[model samples]
Target: MELVSKRAFLQMVSPLIQFKRFRGKINIQRPRLPHFEKAKYLAFTKPWFINPKKDKSQVELCKGFGEKLFEKDKENPFQEIIAQELRRWLTTSRLVVFYHHNPMNAEDEFKAYVMFKKQKMHFKKYGKRTLEMAVGGTPYETILDLYVSHNMTVFSPEPEIKKMLNITKKFPQLVLLAGILEGKLVSKNDLVKYSMIPSLQMAQAGLVQTINSVGSQLVSNLNSHQNTLVSHLSERAKQLEEDK
Candidate 1:
């Protein structure tokens, strides 16, 4: 038997076997295991096997140390813009009605928006923080407490209280809360009373009628004695002429 060179043997077998060259760097570092400061009690049992009281205690244990976990690093640019717009609306609009906005479907909300738009009123919503930023240190600041529970705002150039109330009746989702009207904070009941009040034109007409009635009565009373005296003199002249 003849002993063959290893290189010669490999060269002969290399044609039958193919080798692949790796293109990426090979990582040889060992992965380090994470250190656990305290061991947590992970439940391995089924839901039915878990004790309700113990589960609740475990949940409480997992809670943070009564501190807020997430804090806003900075205000969003859009949020600032919204706050500015809110201030402008509160300042410019003659009527600002705040409502506790109950959830409504898209169709109903669309209808409500259309109804408000037709009346030339604007419906707006903003975050609580945005509202506080906008309303603080302004005349409307008194109403800050009303900015709770999905609150929404409605703005109008005119104090069309009756019209707005009627529109709200059509959409119950917008529960009337409180509003600022003509620079006065008015409650829901006060708004109702205000809606019942007569319009400016009607009130003006009624006032004019009252003044005219008073003037007519005064003229009639002043002319009454003068007319009586004139009638007596005319009768006296007729008697003298008859005698002549």
Candidate 2:
């Protein structure tokens, strides 16, 4: 039964469907101990000092130590860290170090990494759209949308890059060229040229590609089953097939 469930879990994380994790590293201050007490709150937990394999008895309500540390007073700690970490993540731009593995599944981790990585691109796209809305300017769906939609400007193509894009003659099926750098979105083809990557949606496509490249049959099955279950709930599949 457990194997079946784990198989299902893996399937849900399969790259074809593009599952992601939004994990955040947390390093808040631990509780201070009383002069009489032996040590800090960390000392209370057995795992930090003693048995590494077993889970330590969780700490209870004590303001930041509890409220800031764990979620719903449950055994899960990663989710709690995520909540706090996101609050300051964009602002700090700090690297989150992991002492141990996150408790969440691979899907959640994938989403988290994508979200963190593509955060800047999404933000810039949002900013452009927001500004465009004020002047009745066309807001692009993606950063590329701004250029492709308006033919805003022609990029200075590199000598090799121009030849590379010209390969559409040899590979007729080739559609687009994509490149990412420090959360920037860039695309160029035989016709149009480079610009920032635009939105979360675009990032989602890239995420999907990554997942499919690193294929996992189990994860695909899980995701497919979940999709089937969802589609059944809405009767969407039946209606779509009927329409066709």
Best by lDDT: 1
How many collisions between residues are there in candidate 2? 19
Stretches of candidate 2 exceeding 4 Å from the true structure: 1-159, 180-183, 189-244
lDDT of 1: 0.85
- The most accurate candidate by TM-score is 1
Give the lowest summed-lDDT range of ten residues in model 1: 37-46
Residue-wise C-alpha lDDT for candidate 2, range 1-244, written one tens digit per residue: 9888877754444456755656644345764445655556546764735654365444422455765656544443554444343333323322111111214455654554444333321111112223233223222224333423211111211222333334323333223344322333444432234223334667899999888866886688779988988979789777888899
List residue ranges in candidate 1 displaced over 4 A: 1-70, 222-244
lDDT of each: 0.85, 0.39
